[model samples]
Target: MIEIVDAVAWLVDLEVETVRTDAVQSFVKQETVFVEVTTNDGNKGIGYSYTIGTGGTSVLAMLREHLLPRLIGADAALVERVWFDLFASTRATTVGAITSLALAAVDTALWDLRCTRAGEPLWRLAGGFRPKVPLYDTEGGWLHLSTDELVAGARASQAAGWPGVKLKVGKPRLDEDVERLTAVRDAVGAGMDIMVDANQSMTQAEARRRAAAFEPLGLSWFEEPLPADDVAGHEALARGTAIPIAVGESMYSVAQFREYLARGAASIVQVDAARVGGITPWLKVAHTAEAFNVHVCPHFLMELHVSLVAAVPNGRYVEHIPQLRAITHGQMRIEDGHAVAPDTPGIGIDWDFDAIDDRRVA
Candidate 1:
């Protein structure tokens, strides 16, 4: 039996490389909580989860005070069982951000152990549907960028052969958002896809208005126009607009996704593995979205998400937001505008432990 002998958790803070602004908030530092698990036989796996800025200490506390202790002596290979047991143990706090984030760190670590034991990379072990997914650039489309900058960024992505670029919407005025997106659309022309995200900053009425305005621009999707919990609002907006309503990054559970898909509230599902409580449930959400014929374009964590997106049939596009460069050895390889899944055994991120130690706060 590959029993978990030890589990350790810590915190690392990664600074944003550039100023990332969207409709609701500025890009604050990433507060990452990493979990490392070791089996009795000496095999080990690493897993992690993150918050945009706050909640790192809480996630770490949850793991150290509750989750990691339960992991000791548990069968590391039984990934699903471990996930369920841990979730059940934390029933008081189950299905929320802090608990889910803590659970994610532990769950992903177990998956890493499972993949290592199987001697296959996570993409193949998870499903291995495809080794590459087409890329979409989000790094260039911050709401703070001027119209000229947005145009230049979109043009740069187009020149590089990337199929899509996402722009941040929800400006003070409807025309301001329109003006920026119009410039990018004209700059990138008809070949490259243009996606817009409102970051869940607008009300139902405002979203409806923007959807109508953005329809003529030929947008690929309008993401998170309303809060994630506003299912009724999303359903109405989705029904009314021709542009797809993309959502799910802010959601914390599989049930949330089910509600969205069952009601036809969302067209593109942006399941963040970390936010969804790691790969175990993340896969469930993706498969559920598939049943509804919704394509998943997962939000953030590109390194971990690349393998996951490549593993499923209905995986659409991987959002390109580079957040791991400072504490990781290398970047996710982009070949011909598609993000390639790493073939390395276990979760494929090459962590720089030295860098992590330097940045460790807890």
Candidate 2:
């Protein structure tokens, strides 16, 4: 057993260039909490979690006060055991954001350490289903953009050889959403896949109405039309439309994912690693989706998701959002329309500590 020696964490705030607005909220900035763990055997691994703007300090506090201390003398290779310990430790806040984010930092670090020790990339270590996965662009489609801007963005994505482009929905009138989607579809034609996201802004009845309206457009999927916790609502929405329902970035537990999958609520799973505890449980959730014959198309963190999506057979697409380029040393490789996984021995994130240090807030 490789005994753990010490753990450390810090916060870095990354500012966005554009106003990223959706139906529910706007992304003002990214408050990322980074973690590093060292083993007595002279090995170290890095991990991180993210917030859109607030609550990052709370996650860091959870790590410092509750999670980090427990790792001082434990076996670093026992990632799953340590994860379970952390989950049980936070029984009061089980399956919530702060607890899951804190646990993600520790759990991901252990997986990175394990992969480093074995000298294998995370994709190969996980399953090695494919080295590359298809790409879809979400950066071009914000709710604030006009119909002309949406059309231009979709054309650019299509010209760039990306097979899919996602648009933000949830305007005051359903006709407005339909008009924008229709224009983009007419511009890009039938070959290009157009997905739409509501960002959890609508109720079940509203979502069902929009789903019925959107079915004629031949959209690839309708994302987060209803709240993330509304599994029964999602099941009803799924039954109402021919369009597939994609969800899971907001879900925090494997049991929640199981609930979504077992009831046939979601056709595509958008599980985020940081939100689901870390790589350990993320893989479990991916396999569960595979059992249901659903595709695992994770939300954001494309740098890390490249390897993870490529790791499993059921993995489908990686949402393209460039939030980490300023702090990371290298970019995830993109060839034609698919994203290539990083060959780095650990989790494949190459952080620029100088950049992070300059941006560190707490």
Candidate 3:
């Protein structure tokens, strides 16, 4: 039995080489709270908490003051049970962002340790049914870009062999949003899949209005058109339009995700292993989506998600945003617009302790 010996959290700031802008937020740097767990046997596992802007500090506090103590001396092998206990112990506070983000850090670290001990990659440890997951590009079509830029970005993704490209929507003025969507679709032609994300910027009425306009474009899916918590709003949009609705990054638990699925609120379900409270619940959520016959397209952490998606029978597509490319050593591979998971043991990442040096807080 591998008992957890110690744990620590670090704040990592990865310099963003590109100007990432959208209706919801702007980013000059990507900051994450990374968790490092050590076992009594001298093995170490790494995990991270998602959310780039402000919540990272609170996540760090929760991990330091709450989760790490509960986990120490616990068997790392039984990750699922521990995850359940930890989540249940916080019944009063377990259903929201802080709990999920903190739980994700601890849960992900346990999975990392489990796979490392087994001497196999996470995807293989879980199950290696599929080796490659289809890809899509997201960062290029910033909302601040001009219409010509949008077209250029879409065409570039197509020329590079990607099956799909996602652009941000929710321009304060709805007509400008329509023009940009039309320009990108026309430039990319009918061969490629064009998707738009509103980033939860619009009200229910505005989202419905915009979805109506994009319906004729044959968009693959309209992502996060309404606030994630607005289940009735999303259901209304889904019923009102032919375009499938996609959401998950902001959602924290299977119970929360279940609300959307059970209500027929979302057609495309996105589960980020990092954001959904670790590999245990993440797998459960994926299977849950499967039960509903809904396609599962994970949000990010592609290098890690590829193995997960490949393992799941209902796995659809893995989001391929180049956010981690600039900092990580030997990032995931993109070929003909799809990515194949690495066969190497564990999560297939060797944390560059150097790049993440500054974010370390006692």
Compare candidates 1 and 2 on lDDT and give the better one: 1
Ranking by lDDT: 1, 2, 3
Candidate 1 wrongly placed segments (more than 4 Å): none
- The TM-score obtained by model 1 is 0.99
Estimate the TM-score of every prediction: 0.99, 0.99, 0.95
Q: Write the per-residue lDDT of candidate 1 for residues 1-362, one digit (tens) a residue.
A: 89999999999999998999998998799999999999999999999999989999999999999999998899988889999999999899978999999989998899888998898999999999999999999989999999999998988998888999999998899999988888888887888899999999999999999999999999999999998899999999999999999998999999999999999999999999999899999999999999999999999999999999999999999999999999999999999999999999998999999999999999
RMSD of 2: 0.8
Return the lDDT, model 2, position 182: 94
Which pairs clash inside model 1?
A: none
lDDT of 3 by residue, 1-362 (tens): 88888888766666665787888898756567778889889998888766756667788888888878888888888888889888987788877788888888888788888888888888878767787878887767788998988888778878888888888897888889889988888787888888788888999888888888888899999999888889999988889999999988788888988999999898998888877888888899989999999998888677678889988888888877766655468788777888888777777766666656744543
Query: What is the C-alpha lDDT profile of model 2 across 156-257, one tens digit per residue?
Result: 998889999999999999999999999999999999999999999999888888888888899999999999988999998898889999999999999999
Q: Write the number of the candidate with greater TM-score, choosing between 1 and 3.
A: 1
Root-mean-square deviation (CA) per prediction: 0.6, 0.8, 1.6
Report, for every candidate in turn, its global Cα lDDT versus the true structure: 0.94, 0.92, 0.82
